[model samples]
Target: MSDPRPVPQYGEYATPEEVAALRGTAAPGSPLLPQPSPSPAVVSLRGSTLRRLDRPVTIALIAFGVLNLVQFAGVLLDFEGFLEVATKGTSAEPIDFTDAARIGGVVLFVVSLALVLASAAIAVLMLRQGRIAFWVPLVGGALSVLAWGVVLVAIVLQTPGALPPAGA
Candidate 1:
C-alpha cells in the first residue's frame, strides 16, 4: 500500500515527532537551543571588583559625622555654656565652669575627631567595596545613635522643673 502523506524533505516544516527526533540527535552535553542572554542585574553582579554599601547606610554615616563635627565646633565656641547645659539640674552642687570646660572640651574634641576619622574610613572602604565596609558603618551608626540618645536623655532629665515635687 502507498503511504497517505508525502515524505518530508530536509529543510521542510517538521512534524512534532520529527522535531523530537532531531532534538534527540544533538550531541550529549550540548544544548539543542541557544541560551538567552543574562539579565542586566545578573550581569552587573558577576565579576564585580568593588564592594558596595547600601544608600541608607552611607547617608546615615555622613549625617552622623557632620553632627559630631558640628557638636565639636559648638563646644569650641562655648565650652562653658555647653557644660552648663549638659550638667544643669543633674548635679546638686555647682561645678567649677573653667575646670570642667577645659576637660569637657578635650573629651568632646577627641570623640568628634574619632567620629570624623571613622566616617572617612568607612567612606573609603565603601568605595573599594571591601567586605568589612558594611560592619564599620553599622557599628559607627549604632554608636552615634546611642550617643545622641544619651545626650537627649540628659537634656530631658535636667529640664527645669520637669518633675513634680516630692509630694505632688
Candidate 2:
C-alpha cells in the first residue's frame, strides 16, 4: 500500500513536545519544555582574594631566610673570619672566637631559620584562608633581627674587644 502523507521538499522540524517525547522526558501531549542539562562546575585550588603581593612576599621571605641562613652557617664555621670581615672598615676589633661567641652564632642561626620557616608557612595558610598575609614576613624579619641583636649583645658582653673601646 502507498503512504497517504504528502512529502515536503523542506526538512521536517520536530515540535518541542515531540522532541521531549523522543527523549522520554515528557509525553508527546504535554506542553512543558525540556529542562536543560547542567553545565560542569569549576574548582579553584587557591582563594579568590589572593593579592598580587602574596606570592612575591612569600618568595622574598624565603629568599631572605635562605640567604641569612647561609651567612649564619658561614659565620658558625669560621667565627673569627666572619668577625674580621665584618669589622674590616670599622674601628671595631674582631673578638676572639670563644665558646660563647660560637654558641651565640648557633642561637642566632637557629632562631632566624625557625622564624623564616614559620612565617612562610603561616603566610601560605593565610592565603589558603583568603586572608591578607603580607605582614607575616615583615614581622618575622623584625623578630629575627631582634633575636640576633639580643644574642650578639650577650656574646659581646661575654667576650671583650668585640667592639671599639669607649674612648675610640
Candidate 3:
C-alpha cells in the first residue's frame, strides 16, 4: 500500500516554485536539495562594554571605606572612654593605667585619623569617575577593611571577660 500524504520536500517553505522546480529536476529515488547557507554567528558587545571587576570592586571599596570612617569617628569621639574600658581590670589601680591609656589613645587616634583621610581621598577620586579611580578605591578599601579588623581585634582583646570559666 502506497502512502496517501505528499512527501514534504527539503527547503519546502523557501520559495514555492523553487521546491517544485527542484523536485522535477531531481532524479527519482535520489533525494537531493540545495541546502540554505548558514547565517553568520552574531557576536554581542554588551558583555564587553564594562570591565568585569570594576563595578563589584568599586562597590566593595565604598562600603569598606564607609565602615572605616565610622570606626574612626567612634574612636575619635570616645578615645578616653575606650582606653579606660580597655585598661580596666588589667591594672592594679586606675591611676597606674591612666598614663598608658592616654598614650595608647593618642596613637590609636592618630592612626584612625590617617585612615579616615585616606578613605576620604579615595572616595573623592571615585566620585571623579576616572578610570584609575576604580583601583584607588580597591586598594583603599582593602586597607580600610584591614584597619577595621585591627580595631575590632583590639576592642575584643581589651574588653573584660564576660563570663566565668566553665570549670568555675
- Global lDDT of each candidate: 0.59, 0.73, 0.56
Model 3 earns a TM-score of: 0.38
User: Which candidate number would show the highest lDDT if scored against the true structure?
Assistant: 2
Error of 3 at 57 (Å): 2.0
Model 2 has a clash total of: 0
* Candidate 1 lDDT score at position 5: 74
Candidate 3 per-residue lDDT, tens place, 1-168, comes to 765857769865635455555667644333585645444442222333344555566667666656766766665456656655666787422432333344455655666557656765765666566443456666655665575567555644454453334699
Q: Rank the candidates by TM-score, best first.
A: 2, 1, 3
Worst 10 residues of 1 by lDDT: 47-56
Provide the clashing-pair count of each candidate structure. Answer: 1, 0, 0
lDDT of 1 by residue, 48-126 (tens): 5223334445656666677767766766556657766877787522643554345445555566567667766766676
Error of 2 at 54 (Å): 2.6
| Segments in model 3 whose C-alpha atoms lie over 4 Å from true places | 1-50, 91-114, 117-135, 141-168
lDDT of 1: 0.59
Error of 1 at 2 (Å): 54
lDDT of 2 by residue, 2-79 (tens): 658565457887676656756888754556756454443321224333565577777777677778777678776565
User: Candidate 3: lDDT of 166?
Assistant: 64
